[model samples]
Target chain A: MVAAPCCAADDCIIEARGLTKEFSGFVAVCNVDLRVRRGHIHALIGPNGAGKTTFFNLLTKFLAPTRGQILYRGEDITHAKPAEVARRGLVRSFQLSAVFPHLTALENVRIALQRTHPGTFHFWKREATLAVLNDRARELLELVDLGAFAAVVAVELPYGRKRALEIATTLAMDPQLMLLDEPTQGMGHEDVDRVTALIKQAAAQRTVLMVEHNMHVVSRIADTITVLQRGQIIASGSYAEVARNPLVMEAYMGAPDGELRGGH
Target chain B: MRAQPVLYSLAVLFALAVPLLGIYPVFMMQLLCFAMFACAYNLLLGFGRMLSFGHAAFFGFAAYATGWLVSAHGWGPGFAILAGVAAAALLGLVIGALAIRRQGIYFAMITLALAQLVYFVCLEAPFTGGENGLQGIPRGTLFWLLPLHSDVVMYYVVLATFVAVFALIRRVVHSPFGQVLKAIRDNEPRAISLGYEINRYKLLAFVLSATLAGLAGSLKALVFGFVTLADVQQSTSGDVVLMTLLGGTGTFFGPVLGAGIVVTLQQYLSDVVGGWVTAIIGATFVACVLAFRRGIVGELTLLASRARRTLRPARG
Candidate 1:
């Protein structure tokens, strides 16, 4: 495991060194080293099949790496379970919206907050005791602009609203580093703008690492952007710096040289 | 749905009046035992989304344990029943740990396979009396106070226990643990991502469900004065599954109504149909599954909600 040379141990919330994942003989994610700085909206952008999601899964410990080291807050966590990593405040949201569809919007957030309660695993205790969490749960709903729809079941929510609710549930975990997988995927312009702004607000105190397909959202919010193609990092810098790079332009627009512009 | 309280009270009143109306107390006790079994099964299959096909192992094992304790060892009914429940819980812990490693149909198959192993043990064990079963299980006094020799007294005892167990199941269904179970059922990956170790929850539900099913078995052994091979048979597990599904899988009172219908059908139809009773019950289950995909209670709840929606506009 190589220690990050440029940044101090405390400066990075999570660091990956020599991360690799293989399915049979197919290499999904090759040896890659990356650092997510504390309190920054770091966006990982890649073309289709560029191994961005695979890298995210490896970091979350959902899929064990073929060979690599993952450090969370300078501690080796390559062998941690997904839930264990989550409890340590490294949380993730799926590419698809991950709200509990049958539960109400308020209940969705409450489930995330329930881990802190003493009686979370008490099967015999009355569920009414969880009413204490309702106030904080509602506050989270309001944070995502879902206060009015608190009583509505998640299944009935609009697609973009469901994404917002997913974010609300993620926020309820109070994660130190939030890994959002395509937070604005399959959204209308209005919804995307709203969610992009929501992510900015959510990242005020916490660090965020997101895999995004929308160039506009990434350019607007991402402090540092990394471009990946064919299972390897092709370029890493600010949006403008990476956007102008000839390789990134070629990977994105299939052109040898051009300025990367707007949503893909 | 709003009429639930009234409906429940009426049902309880009917149950109380059954013996007075000269409808055999023994039959009613049997019905209550099966109802408890179905409710316990529903706790796992309905709420936890675990379809355990080997629940008969717990049920039958407990009946034999309780029977041996009460008849041979002359143990009190209370202690024997508790012992039976504990034995079932231990078996559940072992089976659940293994079964939970697989999901969906594989999990069901594991339970069925394990329960069959228990069945063969019962079939060959010296204590189970092989094919004849452990007969003449005496229903001892309750806490050494009230004699359970009379069918009427025993009926009331079974009724009280059924009510208490039913209430406990209700409490469990609505608890914070139940909330997490539902979350796991709805979306397991999301639940895991939220930091829940879902396997532990599933195992606990399994053990609790098995213990309650064992309670029903122990009660049946005491009431019937025999522990039969029928108790541990695979059909017994299928019967409870049918009862839960026919009544409604997830609804609170669905399994109870399902058990009532099934038990009543078996009791009344056996006189007329004789050897065809099983065939008739099978046909009825098929018809119910085809007609009510959500089960009787679930369909009723849906219709009630639709009616409420139409009525709200009229009220305005």
Candidate 2:
């Protein structure tokens, strides 16, 4: 492991330099340098095809970059495996609800918590040994207000509840940096509100970098917002600053005359 | 759910009494061996969600290894069988390493192709007796005391082996590691993001399955007093897959039940129909897939769970 460079601005927990991803001749994420500070809610908002997901994947090492380097806590992790990156605490909660459908909601959280437990390979021990994690799993379930549905299979969960379960499972990882990709992609108003609150609670103790289309959600919790259009960062600042930027407004509404709607 | 332990105990008692109850000892032994094989296969296909088409390589090669050792080297049956299991595990590591690089149908095809390679190797190998196979292999005494020369004695030994391995598998399926395998099977990307080395878990599950399958094969060799190329054939691989699907993929008893039904069907059908036996089995599989997609045991479990849910009042 290469030692991270000592810099005065060490609050930048994740730093990407010249990060680029290309598909054939088309560049999906072009020459992006991003620095996410510690313990802040950072939002990556963009119109469709803005490559927010691609950049997220690049940071999490789900997809290798065609060029550039990713440094986590100053350590170069551009070549780390997804699992390896997760092990180092930069975990990702995927779009389309990443919870295991067949497992019970409690089991889903317990499985995530099992990663921190020793003897994860102990196949001979009575399953009662794992009952010890039930309380913690239950706590996480209650944290997401799904405590009553602990026994319900994940697949049977309501859409909003499933996203909450996903966040609960993500929280069980106790990650230093959590990447949530479109956590509220297909939800009604009620679910969106519940999940937005859940994400805020989940982000309380960690750094969060989320890709969201709902400007309301981005404005509500984001300390910093980066607006991207056509694979390039058009504006990066406080939510108010980015929301007022003419370029960011043009990127969202397409023309000068259209009002910048909060929900998309 | 509360009655499960009693049901399992009753099942165990029934299995133990099979030899004493005047059931055909040889036939029962064969059933037990195949049931174990199905259970082993279930460990991968059912739990790990890995479909291997070349499982016969492990099953048949172990038989050959045990038969070669006991007949040629004069090793005791107990030690010879252990050697067979070891050989299968070694083969599993090699095959699993290559097979797991791909997913879904590709994994199945790789295993199938590799098993065919084992089949041809068996056909050409000197000690395996090629087409004739190794015959008249001794049913050496278990632990140098319990004479396996008698079919009744051998039946008990095979039954005991099956029970022990089955229990071990049950333990594995309920263990935390097993839970992780289920998580991986349900959603692999999420499992990886949870910091699981999924391929390692998959490889381990594959090896365990192969080792248990080897155990079944070695026992079959001892009971039948022969090791045949038929055991290593692609058809045998297909048979286990059929049995697993027929019984249930992920359920604990599905594979065993499926194996029992398939082996019984084959035994009876071949006597009268001979050439038509394969077609009949194929038809049965189609019926099962169409109507019982969850497999026999899986559907039964679902029914049982539903019954329990209905009978019990809702709780907070």
Candidate 3:
């Protein structure tokens, strides 16, 4: 195998160089180069079908890139399995809320933490052995403001709480770089604000690369913003700088004259 | 949940009383064997969400192995049964490694194809006796001391094995490993994102299920004193699937209940209706799929929960 060329600086937690994904004849993501610095809320924003999700998939190793490499802490992880990548402290949440529907909210988080304990593969061990993790799992649930609903089954929880549970489960993994795909996709204004604040709080000690359609959530929490148009990076900088770029405005609104709006 | 232990004790008492109640020991033993088989199958299909269409490959193969060891090689029943379980587990490892690469219908198809391959191998293999199968197998002494020649003795042994294996299955279902299996079953992609090596967990579940099924098959061979192509036939696979679905797929006691119903219908109805037992079973399975999609136990549990909810409206 050929060694990936090193391009990221020491502080860069993840770097994508010349990443391209082609499904059959059509290109989904094309030659995207990006870097996420440590402990920064980096948001990848774009209109529908602009390849933001595809790029995120490539970074998380959900989709193998056709061309180019992904480096985590300057180590090439382009061909790693999704679980292996996650085990290396790069966990991701889905566009849809992905809690185990039959499990309680606390049990859903406990599944993530169970791997850290012994006998995760021991069928002979009693499930009560996992009770040791309950305190810690409850702590994580409380972290996401789901403390009261810990005993509730995940499917019974309301829409936004399910997303909160997903985040809580993701947090249980203790990832260094968390990839969230549209954390606030379908929510009321109140839920969107709560999740936005939750995301900001989650990004306190880790790097977050998120694909967000909601510009308000992006403008509020995203420290750095990368805008994609037709699978190519149109602008990459602070949210204010990317919002002021004319190409991003044209991509969002189809008119080059207007400024990129933050709310809604 | 609090009523579970009492229910279990009553079930054990009933099983014990069945022999003293003048029911044929051999028939009850057969029911217990099939019940064990269904429980093992449930661990995969109900809990792991893996539909294996070729479980008879393990079931029939283990029976043949035990029959050959006891009749041809003069092996003790215990060693023969252990060897049979080992053979089935080995087959499970090979099949699971290949089949888990796909999902849904493809996975089921792969298992079916591999099981057909095993069936053909058994048919053509020299020691399997092809059409005649391994017949006139001895009941031989258990551990070369405790005689299994008596029907009543063998019945107790089978019941004990059934009870132990059932408890083991329950233990496996409630364990941390079982929790992970449930998570994988519920959502594979999310489990993957959570850093679970899901394929390994799935493969382990398959092998364990297969091993337990083999235990049932080996026990059945000892009870019948013969191993035939019928044990490994495609219809046997279908019968297990029908039994599991008729009882309940995911519930712990569902498969056992299903196996009991199917086995009883086969034993008693065969004498009355002859070959129409097959047609009756088929119709029952169809009715089960249509009327109670959750299977008997699953629907009952739902109703009981609903009843409790109605009774305790103040809690809400």
Candidate 2 lDDT tens digits, A1-264? 564453125577898889989999899999897888888899998888999999998998889999998889878898899999998999898878999999999999999999888877887877788899999999999999999999999999999999999989988988999999998888999999999998888878889999998878888889999887778788899987887788877877776554567766
Model 2's DockQ?
0.81
**Model 2 off-target regions past 4 Å?**
A1-8, B310-316
Q: Note the residue pairs that clash in candidate 2.
A: none
- In terms of lDDT, the poorest run of 10 residues in model 2 chain A is A1-10
Give the fraction of true interface contacts kept by model 1. Answer: 0.75
Local accuracy of candidate 3 as per-residue lDDT tens digits, A237-257: 998799889999888888888
For residues B1-316, could you state the per-residue lDDT of candidate 3 as single tens digits? 6677898899999889887899999999999999999999999999999999999999999999999999999999999999999999999999999999999999999999999999999999999999999888999899967799998889989999999999999999999999999999999999999989899999999999999999999999999999999999888999899989999999988998999999999989999999999899999999999999999999998898888888897776
Please give, for residues B37-85, the per-residue lDDT of candidate 1 as tens digits. Answer: 9999999999899999999999999999999999889999999999999
The CAPRI classification for model 2 reads as high
Instruction: Find the candidate with the highest DockQ and give its number.
Output: 3
For model 1 chain B, the run of ten residues with the poorest summed lDDT: B181-190
Q: What TM-score, to 2 decimals, does candidate 1 have? A: 0.96
Model 1's C-alpha root-mean-square deviation from the true structure amounts to 1.9
Error of 3 at A102 (Å): 1.7
iRMS of every model, one decimal?
0.9, 0.9, 0.6
